[model samples]
Target: MDGSLKEEQILMSSERDWTDLPPNLIHLISQKLPDLRYFIRCGAVCKRWFSSILLSDPPPQQLPWLIEYDEQFPRASPLKEELPFYSFVTGETGSIPIQESHRGKVYHRTGHSYLLVIDGEVISLFNPLTNEEISLPQLPSRFDFIWPVFGGADPSRNWPWHISLVCDVGRSRYLTYYLDRMRWQCFDTVLHKTCNWDGMLFTTEDHGTSTLVFDAASRKELYTIPPLNEETFGFITSYFVESCGELLRVSLDYNLTRNIETYIFLIYKLNFEGGKGQPHWVKVSNIRDQIIFLDHLTGFAVRATAGLKGNCIYFFIEEHCRSDRFYNDSTLWRYDIATGTCEPVPCPFNRCSWFVPNLR
Candidate 1:
């Protein structure tokens, strides 16, 4: 019972193996993890911990990470193949290496952890998290722009993939590709700023004046919601994001006068209580516990967790050239729906997409 005995006991406890912890205890610990980053780290402790963590439910939705990439990288040589990712939860930067086979390709777009890339006659969807690559057949060279819409299942599940591509070249057209079919079928429709909600695609046409609902699987036009009669004094751009099992339209209104630019945001939710045929738009002052992430092409909603703010919209601002002078640098900004205020969020990357990290 002297000093030597006490020291010996402490040393033994310190050397104990963490893998010996019971699976149930490990599951309990994983449930208390604040974010997916910590959950993933906990799993890396040992094989037993990884197995247990996989059995337990994943941690709550974490803040989306900003994925940074250079679109203008020289394609003549295979250089700068790694893409950097910045996490708001941890305030740290991490990167993943792009495969050499996928190098020298044009990065078309990104959504939900997947990158759409074009290489000559091949179009591929690459997920940096899982290192999974899906190659689609090349489309006619006439269409220039492509936007992916994940349908049928959540973005977290990558299997049984159902993707709809919005191909645009002055006129817009829709195309659907299913894993089962392994082919892309074109749907001639003029849809803009589309979002998927509950297996349906909601889109706006005619400059946000009308909302069109389409059955994603059937490729049939269901109905349309009459436009909101609100008036504003500036140029307006609309985006659709699904929130809390409902469709919400976010309008970004901006005006440039005398070399000064100002922005205003307006939110409206699609109300269906009146009836599906008579659905109406209702102005929403608050988003409750949700946060919206938007880039230039698409936007999505995620529930707020600890260390995150709800009722806010985080979006990217691109650099613009005014009067032969570069005025602003590309950056990220947060707009608070409750306060009706906008502020810049610190980001080191210029061109980025919102990516929610997941193991699957």
Candidate 2:
């Protein structure tokens, strides 16, 4: 082969136009992009790619991303720069720049695909990718924490949100206000957790030992978690995940260490298939092909696909996972549900939660 021919081949490859690809093929390429930043970059390549990205607003099988807290990594300025988000599929990191007035706001809580952020006295549901926010129902000016329940947000019409607000004042009532409802509904219950599967609020008279579902929309008790004898499991934290239309209670009894490598997890499934309110805790040894990701506070389950590992629980280790000791919580891990083993998942960012980016 001639040297000139080889040189021309290199130049031809370098100058190839990606826009020449078919629109249907471009659309297929856009469908697999998990990060909004990737879509933006692909769209910037050419007009055809831009139109392709715009048309693929809600991608098929949107995987959750791990968005690190702005403070978790070194930045020019926490308020000046964008927050980095890592995608599990692409193995790439993208930044979500703080737009307009949301620069100073602090992150409060993470929902399915949204975040509850507090901007002084006003609390808002913020979607970082699209820069869309909806003001939540006003509190009594002295609220402790608010959990945003993710429902119809983006690529769809605005639907009601079942948001839980825990007030730490005079009466100390656990209240939840539905966006569809006009008034805030108060519950006498203490421990509060929102079941992300069906937007059902799980609360109990006891402090997290037993769980019950409280529906603020109708002001009714939908179901009750039978008294789980804490004396038996003796777990410091009872992490609950609703998967496949079943309520699962994962009991972890471990003394966490920086050097330690494994953990013992007792998995329990609520036997409510027979009927509602008649469920009992059944010990399950196998988690099969389902993958669980614990996004800081709540655990999210997804079917293992692509090259992703399954039969494992991806847990965010808040404190020791970061490179800097000063940074409080910023680490991710994959816990094998079968072997009760865990390993740190290497990523460039931290303080991760389940995030589905929506441009629509």
lDDT of 1 by residue, 191-238 (tens): 656665655667775345788787766868887888777676555678
Residue lDDT tens for model 2, 22-135: 878888877776555566788899887777667765465455787765464221123335866788677887777878677766665567666667766776677877778877
Distance from true location, Cα of 178 in model 2, Å: 5.3
Every candidate's lDDT = 0.69, 0.60
Q: Where does candidate 2 stray beyond 4 Å? A: 1-16, 34-37, 70-80, 88-91, 149-158, 166-182, 196-200, 204-208, 218-224, 229-234, 256-260, 286-288, 318-330, 348-352
Clashes of each: 0, 1
Each candidate's TM vs. the true structure?
0.79, 0.76
Instruction: State the weakest 10-residue window (summed lDDT) of model 1.
Output: 318-327
Off by over 4 Å in 1: 1-19, 46-60, 71-80, 135-143, 151-153, 158-162, 170-183, 189-191, 196-201, 205-207, 214-222, 258-262, 274-276, 320-330
The best candidate by lDDT is: 1
